[model samples]
Target chain A: MVSTQARNALAALAATAGMAAFVAGCGTTSDGSDSASSGSGGCKAVSIAYLGAKTGDSANLGLNMVGGVKVAIDDYNKAHPDCKVTEKDFDSQGDPEKATPLATQIINDSSIVGVVGPGFSGESDATGKAFSEAGLVTISASATNPALTTNGWKTFHRVLGNDDTQAPADAKYITDTLKAKKVFVVDDASDYGKGLATGVKKSLGSLVGGTDEIQQKQTDFGPTVTKIKASGADTVFYGGYYAEAGLIAKQLRAAGYKGYFVSGDGSLDPGFVKAAGSTGAEDARLSCPCGPASADFTTKYKADNNGKEPGTYSAEAYDAAKVLLDGIAAGKTTRPDELAFVNSYDQPGLTKQIKFTPTGEVTDAVVYAYTVKDGKIGDATVIK
Target chain B: MQFFFDHFFELTITGLALGSIYALVALGYTMVYGVLQLINFAHSEVFMYGTFAVIWVFTAFGAGGHTSTGGIIGLLIVSVFAAMLVSGGIALLIERVAYRPLLKRNSPKLVALISAIGASFALSETMGLRDRITGFVGLDKPLADYVNGARDNSSLPVEITPKAVFKIGDYSVTTIDLLVIITALVMMVFLDRFVRRSRAGRGMRAVAQNPEAAALMGVNAVRVRQITFLLGGMMAGVAATLYMIRIGTTRFDAGFILGVKAFTAAVMGGIGNLRGALLGGLVLGVAENWGSAIIGTQWKDVVAFILLVVILLFRPTGLLGESLGRARA
Candidate 1:
């Protein structure tokens, strides 16, 4: 065995060396971050970027979008191996602050001809200007904020219905459909969550009982639960992502709440079931601008994803990726040409009538109300 | 004000439970500061590792809704020991890797602090990248259950319907909350005693007061440091286990905010004083609760910091007074 003094000296040397290495390198210990944003040296040099929370609260939603883009890229490359396009993954963690730098990064990478998402509405709002100025096309699968369309970003387009259609339908389902007497509206204080909450509360009007706003990534809901209990509401509508929605639902149940739990598209994911506990998640209602995937797309996605089902916005993201890939297939190779192609785009895609109004919203998009039954997000019914 | 009082008991219980977790975590910060004269920021990761250990044990047992109450108790015992062992081991490793070399070279305090910060980032990011790391070794598929969403929150498999053991006012005191508070109080008491009574504890106290003197008096500085980290880390493990039971979720970055809060608790209680950590944590928890009730829930974090600033301005030594070195041994 080495002597004590020698061991001490060796440890000191090792730690100092380790410190040097860490200080010099940035903290990306994972090989998980995909290759460079830009790929070159070919006729198919243009790349499509998937932007959203690849790893943070509600990452499932972002990963769903990424997976969709992946399927599209994999299928396209398989068909044309000689001229295969590349894809980029920019994980924003669904935060606007994080998305800003990523938006700049995406813009700097000239090969990123189009973006599949900035995922949530807040980041979409934050990054839309830069992408618009840079003439980069983005088609979000799940950003449903009505204000996003009003922002006049020529580069902004979405495959799903906006929250303008969703919130009212959600509110109506809570009031007229569920026939709730009292409603308590809660928001996680996101651009997406708050906007939907406002619409939902307005629609509920006299039926609304109380309201509260929580932060993203907040774990404890004790005080909030007390407030909700005091309100004595029959239904609580959560305007937030699935993670927090699941938590609030779990806490509500723990505190002996027997009311209905409702939430928007942000809270509509398989993650909710895992988070809210199987029993607690039952009967919880959700509204989304998406529907069940077609049999073929589900088969393809499951085959590639180890039998993982396509979560919320997966099919729409596929359609969004298809738009970009189709533009590329038709030789609209440059970012500007891709934007031009999208401006006049219309097709019967996988999820909807793949067409955009001047504001870049799909005209025939439908909103569906879903319920959690037996720990699964149950089948959807067209609510609007 | 009225709403707060109306729900005072419930908030108090909730606050206490949360505060206890903070207190347990704070002890790691306070004790490390006491002896090493350095804040172990990676102490949070020590707690985080404990939390993951707790989840892994439960996953291994396949503990869930169907788990009998007796089975849960057995699982809880096993999980606690597993968490303690992992946390304690990690704590010792951290001291050896992050602190020992610096101490050997007589580095500046700032450099030491930076070293600890680097260690902190390295530890948390390494956990966040567990999936990719496992993938490198072709173990990703086998370890998918543990590492599938390394950066995301992984919850306990159990679906618990928290049963109220008692009632106060309109609130029902759940068994989980009671267990969290009691467990924390017991650990704090035990740690306080250990620091005051045991041989290793005496060595730790001697070092905190006068490292050179303690060294002259035949106390092994390295061993003292290791013991300090071990005890502090075990405390964090207890906190982690309770956190798993109470909050039922843990993320890779879960430690960041909680670490900040626990550090705040250590400071508010008078950093380095054991009793101060307990008082500071409880007060911070209840104060935020009451503050939220009066103003709004969104202002809770703002209230916590405002209280900290007030505490710092008036009582800089914290509620108990700073310096474990100077405290009665």
Candidate 2:
């Protein structure tokens, strides 16, 4: 009886496998026609897809990018009514698994001329290959992993400086300005965080007191706090987003560590202060490539978003969207034309002159330092 | 050796505080397993709901900053009660929705376990998507704010400041630590004594031993199982409040790893044993901290599982052995 049951199960599995293969073959043939038609004949209403987490832990950053994209789209439509553009937003929730299908959808959707972002490095890394293969040009506002540009993706571009550019300023602030004899580094063990942490470590050299890694979404930092306390480093530089950074900062302070706590742009959110509490976030500094949006842009954004000022990458996101919109306005409708246009694209933007290297990095992006004073992110000071 | 000695007192206090939370959460897992002989994987969601309950309560009251001692005590009492009540309700709901139907149909234990895993995901994802749900309901202003606040680590305004009560060596004992450790001990002791000398507790033991026998002996087996989940969830609720107070922040998935550790504690302390849960939690917590101190922080979780494996290898029945249902036999 058992042998018969096993044989039947194997037979059923083989039949199902055969059926799936037949279906998949049909699916590919249909998909090829769909992409071919969309690629050649652009839709009457062109869309710039905004892809990122608009609802999860990283929603603050993603929403800001969306807001910036919205403003750029609106500005472009008002200026050029004859060549109108629309925006398509996809919420990846800052998860790579979610971004993969969304990337495919964006690629298959022929109406999408360009992308404003895959706001996070993880999502960009996950979807870059698909976008590159589909010849979809994605101008990321915030993804800054140095390796993202080196992935041989011809259609990928970012408006913000990568870790390679940002880390030198961070190391300088830690070693020269703070002048700490000893420094400890912590990362969330992501492609972005580890890259930035390692870069800082290389710059600091012998001044590096200790180094540690943490997982994303990890809450309890009791052991990590103890380890940091024992390290006796005068400065602690954390390379992670706000959620973990705030908790670590709070726990570290509660444990009576009075040293300087520095973090990267990933932690530059109002939520950081809210998470760290007033006392815990005291004197903490956040370094980022993008600063506050321009005064006029800030006022306009506040009006648009119920008096909510744009967050960390809002200015850069606006710049990124502007770059793509400018390319679209210049009659770069098809994916290949837009990709080529963005490659040689040079225009003044909200944050900086929007120009990309052959590798798709912003050539003249500047890093800025912002200190947390009185429980708020203070005005940015340009860090040379 | 010097590092260990220097940080000994600090580590010990931190470990004890951490252990107290594990013990509280582990009781729910242990008690449910004691009666059902199945892991209610959704017990973690019960604890997570308790954390949000405290957040909702505190936020509703606008509780923030340093409160007066009396105010702090009052807030703690109210929040703890709120957490317990919400968690208990959710636990009962889970058992009713996820476990009772399976029990009635006499389904396999694996099916019930799978149901519990589904319930766990459903609860956590609901919390994660609370904002979207609330917005859909058209209560977008304040309700959306509350739900979105929980999307990430919602840092509660510290209602009670952790003042240094005393110093042992270079480590100072804070009031929050004392509160967590003391509250956990009190709850555990009360639970221990109650289980040893209560009608319901006896019913629980009878049901655990043999449901048919217990049903024959005038104890409602189903009711006893529900009560067991209730008691366990209440304990977890108290654990949640203490956790939020000690950690000062709670996220939607906060209970996951901690729940795993608590389950490991339950298994380590002899799955069905009451005292074993406490012993297992304290031992696991201290050992994890010490292991991290020695090896590194990233390997802290690795150290915890390794210890669990080593202990189980030595004594498969666990350190204390299963004794929940045995009546002095």
Candidate 3:
């Protein structure tokens, strides 16, 4: 019995060793094959990728941008059938950790010549360096954190103006227009929200009454709302996406706060109005670098997307895609050639005359203040 | 100090309402741990599905913000029952599929725990991918529409509006707050009575003490465990509806943090003690609010966990220091 047991143990050990070796071998072989397959220079049908959340709390924003990019791709493909351009979508689910792996995958796939988005500020911050080192050209349509541009990523660009531009515009609207003396600043503690809140705080100065932080996906805002009530602030500036912004606005109103509710581009979606309810979102103001898409673009978007009106950043996404398609049309097909083309890119597109600075900042980006009136986001008026 | 005094009544009222939710969810964790000595990590998913059930029922009836007071009451009852049935069903399914197999094989405690975690993830991701799953099955459009979408924060149209019911000092109490608190108290009283006096409750205690010994007493351990899960899940379902009424929104992962807090409450109250769960939850809720009022809102969770650690250091078995098997009603 003892001898048989010893023989079985030896067999088990050998089997375990063999399995571990097999798994390790598989990993190395896959990596070698992946590298071997890429880096071929030939006339291949190049594609641009849309990297953002297509399903989640922020799905509306990402899906809308994808819609806009698809329009640009359709127009480009229709114009140039031989030099065919296609779009591949990568869903990050609005998570930064997910974006990192997807970014690495995008970098490995050499067929993807350029990218239209990583849509959110958090995802952009997470994947910026990987794309930069890989020399992959990425033009973000929505990410507005000013710190993103400061990362010194040569391949990164954005069509929207940064928070530094829009925060002051929001502060001016709150202080000069509404003339609110005491303002309470709140953020969801996300990278995007905190940066914008800090910018608003700097612009507001002494008018800022206090600052508070909340987590994303927080449903109850009673304690924060009560604190806001006690602070006796006449204006409440929230720096977060539409999900929490709507709840905060609704709860603040319920807690008897009747003041100007102001936020940045993150709160510029129609879902914000739906979340806040018509009564809660009455007279709420949102400042964004992206103005309303022109009537023609809106019509085209509606036609393409089954009559679903485009939400935040759809126009800018179209413009970003146009920048790449224009470059490809002008004989810039390779990654290096596309990067150089976008670096010195200048053209009139849907949103505005698109031009990138050396640091990838839009040359003439403008901020617009939008008001919620009668349960609808009103027409955008230039903040200045 | 001034902030504390001025908002004392309002803070207390809010704390009580929030505490009631924690208490309902805590009962589930405590009871499950009592019978199986396993923390049902997937209890949060049970609560989450309860929330969806509430939404589905309301939507099916075409209820909206404009529903009348009587209509709201009727809808609330229907939705609460629907939530309870759905959550209880899901809880039984989880036990049969995730835990029973491990228990039958006499697996190590650590393996059962890992299984619980896996089950938790599976349920949450399934809900998150509801749309894709429905689309793949080629369900009819209207049915698919109901099952799909809303992976993010979805708010139910306000069926019950908060109207001032009465005033306490300078603070006004709303009808919704009163309703939630009263409903929670009623459920707690009924559960307490049922556990102390019922025959099945005695079977649960016997099994919790020793499954083999309980088998010798002719008590069906398997049936007793299922009943315990059903009871816990029903309480969680009630809590889910109250949470929706109070917060007015639900998300796929909404139950995660709340579940952690509820489990912490159960541990604080002495895991497996029913009455202790209620006391622990109320204390946690009030303490967190008052702490936030004193310090800052951002430090509320920090203060709660700190209090727990300090309490554990003193009384490791928790405040009441008695499991369900040994405790009186």
Candidate 4:
């Protein structure tokens, strides 16, 4: 009835409206993914990256750390709509081979401003060079190798105590308080294991004069136990993760060495108890850069997890995310220049007040020792 | 002399018992390699998956939790059979999805190797990814609960208490250790009989000797290959059941390193030899334990590799030497 031009114009308008409606429907999600930032002036979406072991042997640890970061992001977004941050996570899998590629990917991404981790110290080294080259500000919740901060990687930071501090403290404890002389040492041959063992050996050497080295993943300690007995060593220091440690402890007791057994944080897991059983596990001392079981964090974490156990490193992960968010708010802009807001992280974190030296290592961190009693880690001694 | 007298039998017995388990897992690798010269890198994962299957089925059917000796034995039998079936099916699927397409395309042998590695990665990640996704949906806890409930119900009468010990004269052995050893020996006997007596096993060996010749003789090489995978996987499933009984809990990546070691055992015994697998596994286990005993436990894995290299260097055909097929270049 009307002119063709008028009809065509109406149709065009209706089609435009339909497309708009479809886009609006697709973009709006009930999930927190679509929530707007709550800042006074809604900031552009900020992309934060988290890197850790996700798929390989250490995937469990990696998954837990990332889980904590996600919780922090969700909580932060809910609290501050203006702090609109989109989180991206990549798994390094505690493998140097994987870490190099993953770090390159994270560095190449222009949207990443701050990073939560590459969980292990060994992995941190693998990716630290790439990150530093890009001027990216990174904080690790668990990387403890002292050598990580040595190569002058300006952007690297860790919230946990370095092996340098922890190992010496551990050696001192075994030799002085425990008065355990003639110690035999074992390491996983990993950066963490070797470094900590070296540190312990240096201190123990000062007291007991020398030490012995063991290979990683060994199930039988009979030869070592024999040697320990021969050397009159009353203490065995193990610098490895839980798997081999548990096996070694079982064999050591079985061999009747009648010596004290000591190890680092890697041996602190409940699985150690399960593997070694009760008698062998008891009286075994373990050292960890202590983080008190956070009642508040645990309560919230349990609630989120429906009362199941949270992963070991989740608290550190949450704290890492919090530090990054603080950095983001201080930066005043969400653009991906990593150093733009580095100064904003000057504030204290949940576990400790983080202050990075020229090389990004924490200047003040503490380690503590615990004795295994009744299939759990317990004790109240801080090693200085 | 006193110390040697006290611990000699204990160490040797312990070594032999542990060696039995290595033998059980090694048979899977040897059988498949005998037929297909392919490593079946996913074999360990098949073992791991079998364990989860046992856990899942035993739990799902309400066989888990505290049980008497008879109840425990019942659960063990059912679990072993369930694991065998599931693992066999998974092996078939892996071949169908990853290997068959490559074979049909006439891809290079290297491609098959890469595909096997990829398949291993894919299977491991699948479980891990499922866990992550479930966590996001708040379903992880509930799932864990379901699995835990089953585990609790299917528990054996030899209770897992810290103080639990089994007395044998002056020496004491843990219930866990005793169970692991007994189960491993039984599996070895079953596998030995199955390979020597079964009609399907002969078909497998014929295909292994010469696939083209077997095909010409109307032996359906494809069917033989499938059966080999099934048998190999069934062996792995049994091994997994033994492993779970010893290890207590399972993880997605649990088989990664252990699988590599088992494969190394296969190679150590001479790739295509069945009896060689058993011998090689026991030797490797004893060697590993002794290496750790001599040099500290930390060196155990490295020692295993060293032993492999040394054996390959001197006796290129392996300790048991080659029995069938061409020696590896």
Best by TM-score, which number? 2
lDDT of 2 by residue, A146-253 (tens): 788999998899997877887888999998778898999999887567778888999889999988888777776777787788889999999877888988998889
The lDDT values for all models are: 0.83, 0.82, 0.81, 0.67
Which candidate do you rate higher for lDDT, 1 or 3?
1
Model 3 chain B: ten consecutive residues of lowest lDDT:
B144-153
Candidate with more favorable, higher DockQ: 2 or 4: 2
**At residue A344, what lDDT does model 2 achieve?**
92
lDDT of 4 by residue, A48-152 (tens): 778765544355666678777877887777877655677776655565555566677667666577888877766677778888888888888877766688887
Off by over 4 Å in 3: A1-60, A73-138, A147-156, A323-348, A374-378
Docking class of 4: incorrect
What's the true lDDT of residue A248 in model 1?
Answer: 92
Global lDDT for candidate 2? 0.82
Q: For candidate 3, write residues A222-288 as lDDT tens digits.
A: 7788788888999999998888898888878876788899998878877787678777787999888
Model 4, span B1-329: residue lDDT tens = 44434445444555555666677777778877777777788887787678777777656666533456676667777888988898888888778887888877878878887888898888876655554566778887878633332211122212233222665544456565566667766766676566556766666766777888877888877777788788778877887777655544455676676677778888898877777787787888777766655554556778888999999999897877755343321
DockQ for the candidates, in order: 0.42, 0.47, 0.41, 0.18
Which candidate do you rate higher for TM-score, 2 or 4?
A: 2
Residue A253 in candidate 3, Cα distance off native in Å: 1.8
